[model samples]
Target: MVTPSTQEKARLGGRADVGAASVAGAEYSTIEHALSDALAAHGITGLAIRADGGIHRFDSADKPKGNRNGWYVCPTLEVAVYGFWHTGEQHTITTGGKADPAAAAETRLAYQRAREQREAERRAQQARTAEQARRWWAAAGAADPNHPYLTKKRLAPYGLRQRDTMLLVPLFHDGELVNLERIYPHGAKKALFGGRAKGVASLVGSLASADRVLVAEGWATAAALHEAMGVPVVVARNADNLEPVARRLRQRLPDDVTITIAADDDRFTEGNPGATKARLAALAIGAKVLMPTFCPGCARCTDFADVALCRKERVA
Candidate 1:
């Protein structure tokens, strides 16, 4: 009986010592703290850390509320990764003094996996949004020519459809309808969430049998150019998209078809982004650039549509 009691006490002491060591290790190697510090360095704060090795999304500090542009993944107790999808910002945190070769390799693999997962999810979301676009477009009616936006812009409907007071501008990519730009009566515009926009475009007229084509930034600019020049106009939707849309058109059209980028002269804006992007796009494809030239002493016109409307108003 005496021997048995002594052995039991020795076993209990050993267990207590192991438990204390484990607690000390946990206190010293807190991965969550390191991750929090890393995020703080990027101005991202107030996020609950998830250590399950799964991607978690949160709103970025700079974006609007509910944007959820920030995401993080903790693949192991020692490694964590986070990024902002909107800004393409990524950061990683690791515990311990310096990462060993194996730990570094593991972190790289985790980062790659996170990126792949994000891409897959993005593709799926885009597919769903595209299907929704098709449904809404098919069920809509022809755009009312007297709509406020059309009347204000002095543009015709030009194959646009309308649902209630909102005009739907269909965007296509790879010869498939992939998105829609909803233009409200107040001139506000929005594209479907998760829908593809890069390299997508809207057309104001037929390109078939045409010897020349013009690419413009907005629908109104494209419409004005098409109406004046009697040439099909491709609406790249914005300055940033000018290059991608022009590149795709160059690839699809025959070599003899001359491509011209109709630029918006944003004189008031620093760097003149519209004209700058247009010139870059034109240079990329060996195309010509056409910028709207405002009248003498006129400072209000920025694009072809604005120039046309301003001139017409002056004449009246």
Candidate 2:
């Protein structure tokens, strides 16, 4: 018969000799399911557990108390629980603690369950976002010829060489392409703007017959406002470009025409170079500036596109 002390020594040696065990077939699904079952046993819900070569803990429904450290514990002879914090690092406990072994194991298992779920959810969301981007590009490629903004040249510039269907160019006014900001389906890093050309000019010529013209940085906001109010609009491309564009506009437009600069809230913040540039531009050009009534939950008011996208979420 194996003595208790001898068995304990063997068990301790097994954990200490990390290289002795091979991790060749450690499937995340198996570990994740085990962690989920463990949390359910402990009456904890909405916890997530993740595992690569090891396990991690997270809270899916709420932020956990404490410093958001990933905690890990070995619950069985073969299973270990691990946790992850926002920084994507993992943590584990293999020694003594204030709590009893069983309670500590339960806590660690709960954390692992939560971490696994979070990782899974993050991957799912990324997949969905990619799919949405693909659909947007396809739709852009098939743009209607009769549409005022849709032109073959405009669509051709944004088409991805690798994926002809994907267009990175964003629609600014009706269908007019602005500054060629980015080519789509290629992803964020591939966004290209009209070099030195302000995006606001995309809508400058398309404005309604009004004495007052409203200007913003982003194409989306300009388009949204134009759609909402039958008024003339100019998009500055970005905050820094606004002043120069405004100066040019002042020269071209009738002297009595009122110009309003749409100030995005981001400009007022301490370290925004773009906002600082816009302020100087507005001051020099003698243009009246107006801020959106609602703060768009970010730094700058670049346009009405953000307002429309975020308004429903803000209200809810």
Per-residue CA lDDT of model 2 for 163-279, tens digit only, reads 343334332322333323442333232333212243235463354456889777755456556656657677666777788678877877787788877665564557755456656
The clash count of every prediction, one per candidate, is 0, 33
Candidate 2, position 266, lDDT = 66
lDDT of 2 at 144: 34
* Model 2 segments more than 4 A misplaced: 1-179, 183-195, 198-200, 267-269, 295-303, 313-316
- Per-prediction TM-score, please? 0.88, 0.39
lDDT of 1 at 126: 92
User: Over 4 Å off in model 1, which ranges?
Assistant: 1-28
State the lDDT at 263 in candidate 2.
Answer: 60
For candidate 2, the clash count comes to 33
Model 1: colliding residue pairs: none
lDDT of 1 by residue, 1-316 (tens): 0000011111211110001101223332666776666666667787778788888888888878888787778787876656777776555555654445555455456657766887898899899999999999999999999999999988889879999899999999998999999999989999999899899999999999999999998888888889888999999999999999999999999999999999998889999999999999999999999988888999788999999888778887
Residue 94, candidate 1: Cα error in Å is 2.1
Where is the poorest 10-residue window by lDDT in model 1?
A: 1-10
lDDT of 2: 0.47
Instruction: State which candidate has the highest lDDT.
Output: 1
